[model samples]
Target: MPVELDPVKSAQKRSDYNGIYRLEDLTRLSEAVLSDSGQVDVMLKCTYDEQKLPVMLINAVTDVDVTCERCGQPMPLHIELAATFTPKTMRLEEDLVPSNYAIVEVNDYGLVDLRALIEDELMLEIPLVPKHEVENCAIKEQDMVWGELDKAAYEKPSNPFDVLKSLKNPK
Candidate 1:
């Protein structure tokens, strides 16, 4: 099961949680992956920083297969995430959040869904165009087809003015 806890409360107690999220649990990420069976190892620690701000440290890792854009075949992709985030209770706090730590929004109940957060972070780590290395991809750059001109389409069309010229020249 995925981990979900109150960031502020957990931080006050300096709590730590470790869990695994099945790929299927992440609906958005599952759609982008080639295989349906996999799991992400997640570790979350909530504590008060020296500035008296509640922060959470997150670490997540996963291995999955994504379609190679070049060859249209499945390729292995490893995703790793490490981030520090301070809970933002109000829009005004956005400016107060330190630049070194990311800001995660807290709900009216002061709870932040760690499962969704990890899924979102994983999605961001995925490459826009997943592909195997040049030496490994079945399709190479030289094999790519940009386009080809049709021989019939490129043939010069008969000029309408040619008839008039032929009549004037008696040819």
Candidate 2:
């Protein structure tokens, strides 16, 4: 279910409300934006303050099937994310920033697209270097070969001065 925020009521000091959201709604969001193979499950408790600031206290567990970066094998990943999202009306200066974090805006009526918000949060939680932990993974040999090739490509050449010295020494 979507959350509705009444800005007028919020501005009048009628804030501090809570609600329970479901996991199926989050899955639908993943289906719309993510690949069909991707899956997400989430539950969140949302709170609003008198300033119309929405704070989402989220606890989520997800299993996503994605191509592994290290081994080229299909990897199934499990992730648990617990975080809070705060909606702000104004952007703070860089010097005064609390921390480096993402900020989303609340609409005039304080209505937020929970689907989109959760989807984005899940995307951010994905690992940059995905890999499988199982031993003897199908692509392990292939990955080793690729690693050797990469090492060769980046290896430093022997110093020309050193080469000349070696030649002079006949060693």
Candidate 3:
């Protein structure tokens, strides 16, 4: 079934959900202007831990088209994310969150928009610097020569700080 969940109630029931959603339907993802039409497959479960903390687990996979930073070409990337979230009835201090899980707020209405949550996670998964594999990239020539000093300049270059040092130290 779909993943629309009331986090609190779902946790009580220890329910499991599975669904597929079109990538285009996630408006935030469209902001990147991705080139491909894809679908996100999601698996969700709501349960409690040994401490009876309300927890939600999500596993999702999808393909996304992103621009390669080096070549400026669209590349298809496969993304899979698995994470766990803890929902609190009352706002808790950040320090109270355990190391292994994330805290998601349960709004006053008690509805958790799983779609938006997944979208947020997907956004975070995008690479800060997306690039194709080095072998596949077209920038080999530019990369090789990017920092090379001009071999044609045979003359020794004058020191830029020589005049300043001479003025200050009078040596």
Relative to the unseen true structure, what is the C-alpha lDDT of residue 93 in candidate 2, on a scale of 0 to 100? 38
A best-first ranking of the candidates according to their lDDT comes to 1, 3, 2
Local distance difference test, candidate 3: 0.81
Query: Which one is best on lDDT?
Result: 1
The TM-score, computed over Cα atoms with residue i paired to residue i, of candidate 2 is 0.55
lDDT by residue (18-89, candidate 2, tens digit) is 343443455653443324553445555555534444455566666766667766766766667777656554
Candidate 3 Cα misplacement greater than 4 A, ranges: 1-4, 91-96, 141-171
Give the better candidate number (1 or 3) by lDDT.
1
Candidate 3 lDDT, tens digit per residue, 1-171?
A: 353578778889989888887887888876774653788899998998776778899999988888888889888788888999987666555676678898886667877778888989988888988998888887785474665577667678899999898899974
Q: Which of 1 and 3 is the better model by TM-score?
A: 1
Over the stretch 1-171, how does candidate 1's per-residue lDDT look in tens digits?
435668888888998888899999899999989877989998888898887888899999999999999889899999999999888775335766678898888777877888888899999999999989988999986876778767987999999999899889984
Greater-TM-score candidate between 1 and 2:
1
Query: What residue runs in model 1 are displaced by over 4 Å at the alpha carbon?
Result: 1-3, 90-92, 145-171
* Alpha carbon lDDT of each predicted model: 0.86, 0.56, 0.81
